[model samples]
Target: MIVEGKVVKLGDKIDTDVIIPAKHLKYTDPSYLAQHVLEPLDPEFHKKAAEGVIIVAGRLFGTGSSREQAAIALKAAGVKAIIAESFARIFFRNAINNGLPVLACREVTAYVHDGDEVAVDLRSGEVLVKNRGVSIKCGRLPELILNILLRGGLVEYLKSAVN
Candidate 1:
């Protein structure tokens, strides 16, 4: 699968709390969580993300809390994908489990800037920065993970498998 969007740059160690603060975790509804996604880090994130953006962040992104809501909120807010230097293990799994494609490209942040148009090919793990004419390689997701994402998260994948 391929995901293309304008970039939304962020720094290191963005945790679950900042992604969707606990105060807003009252509901598991994605749309509701989207409204509060990154409210602590960027007050206008909801509006900016609604227009479809890809987040590119530094190492240890999603470093705190294992709440799956962070991934849900981001996906609902129209974040097509997230490219980070590295991710907290649980967050990475949670992202894929929620059908939020995340790529780990060590040099991605170097090539992408905020608002730059980029395209990500999940199968090839290539991150192309359109305006700059640069491509960064990230680890390709395994077929099983890809299948889960394609089916729209773990639960859906499981449901389909059983049927």
Candidate 2:
């Protein structure tokens, strides 16, 4: 999917707690998770962060947590992809497993900023920086992850695996 939005910039080491506060975990449904996504960062985050907007963050984004709900929260909140300098392995895997597109870029955070409308090419792993005359390069996704994403997520892939 091609996403264009004003970035809601975040710093390094954004963890699951920041994505979805622990207080809301009582419910199993991911719908609640979306409500609390990034609530800690901005009480009105849900209202301000438009759906299909891209979340741009520094290193270690999605660190310090392994819960799948974290990815679900972002997805449900309409976050299309997370562009970060680095990400926690578990969270990265969780994102793709849940059909959430994530890309790793070391220099993206430096060139990107809040409220900057950028275009994300998920298939190409490139970000066309609007008016900056620059493009952020995100390395290619693994074949395994691509296959899962192409199938609409890991579960769907598994269902078709035996065919």
Count of residue pairs whose backbone atoms collide, per candidate: 0, 0
Q: Give the per-residue lDDT digits (tens) of candidate 2, residues 20-51.
A: 88787776586678778888888677766545
lDDT scores in order: 0.91, 0.82
Error of 2 at 103 (Å): 0.4
Summarize candidate 1's per-residue lDDT along 41-84 as a digit string, tens digits. Answer: 88888999999999999999888887889999999999999999
Error of 2 at 162 (Å): 5.1
- TM-score per candidate, in order? 0.95, 0.91
lDDT at residue 112 of model 1 (Cα atoms): 88
lDDT of 2 at 57: 92
Which candidate comes out best when scored by lDDT?
A: 1
